[model samples]
Target: MSPFAMRRRHAFAAGLALPFARTAFAQGDYPSRPVTVVIGFTPAGLTDTMTRIIAGRMGRELGQNLVVENRPGAATSIASAHVAQARADGYTLLMGTASLAINPALQPSLPPRDPRQDLAPVGMAYESPFLLIVRADLPIRDLADFVAHARAHPGRIEMGSSGTGATNHLLIAMLAREAGIQLEHIPYRGAAAALTDLRGGRIAATWATPPDAMPLVGDGTARALAVSSRERMRTLPDVPAAPETLPGVHGTFWQGLFAPPGTPEPVLARLGAALDAATRDPEIVRRAEESGVVMRPGDGGALRAYLASETERWSTLIRAANIRAE
Candidate 1:
């Protein structure tokens, strides 16, 4: 080979390699500035509160602020779409809830039509089951009594939920199917409104998160009948798990961290590590336990698998029950 030909070949190879090297270097320097985590619910709700708690810890690990912003609407589709369409630079993320999986099956027209394809799973944040509570004044004493009462009334016991197609609402439908009872469903704008009606005795029952229900249960305004998880929670040891009464009836409200699709592998790893660390933090675990939430620290692959399973589970139930978004 001539000297001139060898020189040309080396120069061309370097030119092609330069761009690839630069891209890798850029991805390595992730989160050069503050990162924003968008929440799909209003501030002070269980999702918002848990996101803030975990974000604060993650910020310390990343050495950058994880600014949380609320964009509550369309059953969380607005926030999901915003983050899904944002730049995949690890700077903007979504603290997606179980609604992420439920909405796609429940409402096919929503902005984020396919979560697995639109967003990159960063990691699993936390999971907690819903609490089945009824008005304290009701004669219902436990899950058995509640089932018998509903069977007796048959679509007369008004059950309130955050909204139609919400996780808690789906649990209500699942309970009715599994227990072979019919209950009237009353949808509200949010859990707080449903809880308010339950407190006033306008609604017979509703499913609530521990954080939201504890205040009323503690004061004797409402009585907790059962938990929707597969097993009893360590914090709420006395509440019977729903599966004991009706086999195969279990559901949970879960949160997972996500980035826009096509995010760099290095960036996803960095973010996932921060999330795993945050969930395992001593204080975070303690607070989660106190609130009856279970911390599920896992990597992007784990989140992807979990999301797929949840989507399948909810989709089957939604279709079988003919659940439509409100």
Candidate 2:
């Protein structure tokens, strides 16, 4: 064949293989390298602890390591912003918690980036209810009795929280609203201080996660009266669900896996699948349950929906309570 004819034949052959090549590249071994999971809290914190648990199994399922990186500050707004600004390549992700949804409404200084818009929810990891803990000597025994006492006492009783706009604060505010009473909510720099006060009989109550409250309850330092979940927590089955006495009060320290915005659908699907599988793993469930967490495994869309509902729910209470960051 002539030179031009030979060139045309080669070009045609290349074109024929181009589509297959593109397909292969698109479907290439995703996550050929390690993926980093970012948490907005310090190590050993609730968010970090759960992310560490689920990310390991997810890494195994994805055939790559899932590294847990801590960037705790500004009530997780800093780490959340970091993940929100990261490249949309599935390699960077956030083990986002309820704080991500709650912070925008709570922190006036936090430049607004709707988590629903800025980050891609990969999947739900797990959720843990806040236990309403009081000093063991307090007459409050269960949620109903607590509500009645708060109603009778009004602003006289003190309710403590981690911070002014924290989930614990929002939960207590919601409880106050539901009971038609006023609680003198005292905000602290950390749960430890609030818990310490509760143990010392300085504060009436504080909303605490299982990790923070269960130990105190176990040692008779505090009494768990109720859990802020719609239903009973399997780990704290003896405690009544707050919603039983006050309907629609389901506040939890829920967490979801997230990626930066614009991450491709296929990458998200893979991560979500691995997450769903790993979160449901029997050992993962057992570990999380042992820590008083309820394993919730779902897809990105479900996570998005959950975030939306949580944001609305928490924001309304924060506004109603006039909650602002300390």
Candidate 3:
């Protein structure tokens, strides 16, 4: 070929590659500014605390502070929608809770921006076990006693949760079906409120994460009847697992990192790596262990699969109970 022709062809190829090259560079230099991690609930809730702890480590690793913003409302739909509509850049992310998966099932009419489609899971932060805690003075001493009392009282037993269609609410609905007991479900603005009612003796029971419930239960303010996991919590060895007490009853709350759905794959990878490293941080691990949080460090694909299965699991029960986020 002639020299002039070769030069022209090379220029044409470079022109074609320019846009792709720019995108690659942008992804590589992600989070040139502070990244925001949005939480759907108030500060100090299980999800909020876990995200704060991990974001600290992740910020140090990425050389850019990960700022956590709480946008709690409408059962996390507010935060999920905020993140869903944000730029697809890695700068904005959601400290996604299991409620993201269950919200749609609970509030179908609320038009939740479908986290599975609107956000991309970066990686799991940690999984927390919820305990079925009752007012310490309730006429129940164990799961058996609680079950009998609930059966006897039927709709009189008021079981409170963070909110309608929340994990605890749905788990109680599932329990109603499995145990053939009637529970009058009470949903609060947040777990803190519901637990407050429980402690005040205004409510019969509530589902609280170990981190939030540990202090209250330890202080004799509440009694943990059974944990939601199949295995008992090491710290709460006296409490039996729900599945053992009542077959097929299980639920857990997990937190993950998520970005706008259209985020670049390379950016997602970079953030995922940061999250993986943060989850393994020694201090983070120690704090999580003390709070009964199980370290999963699950990646994007694992989180996606978990969302799929959890959605299906909770949807079935929600539909069965005709539960919604009213």
- lDDT, candidate 1, 1-326, per-residue tens: 33323433454465456677447635566677999999988898777888999999999988899999999888899999898777666889999989888987899788678787778899999998889999889898899999999988899999999889988899989998888899899999888899999888899999998988989999999899899988999899999999988887899999999987756667888899899999999999999888879998988999999999999999999998898876
**TM-scores of all predicted structures:** 0.90, 0.90, 0.85
lDDT of 1 at 142: 94
Report the lDDT tens digits of candidate 2 across residue range 1-326: 43323433454466456666435426956888999998888898767778888988998899999999998887788887787777666899989888878887887456325777777789998888889888888788887878788778779889899887778888878887878888998999989999889888899889998888888899998889888888998767788888787786768888899887666667888899999998899998998888888999899999999999888878888888787776
The 10-residue segment with the lowest total lDDT in model 2: 1-10
Q: Judge candidate 3 at residue 253 and give its lDDT.
A: 82
RMSD of each: 7.7, 8.8, 7.8
Instruction: State the displacement of the C-alpha of residue 85, model 2, in Å, after optimal TM-score superposition.
Output: 1.5
Which stretches of candidate 3 lie above 4 Å from their native place?
A: 1-18, 21-23, 109-112
lDDT of 3: 0.80
Write down the TM-score for model 3: 0.85
Cα misplacement distance, residue 100 of candidate 2 (Å): 1.7
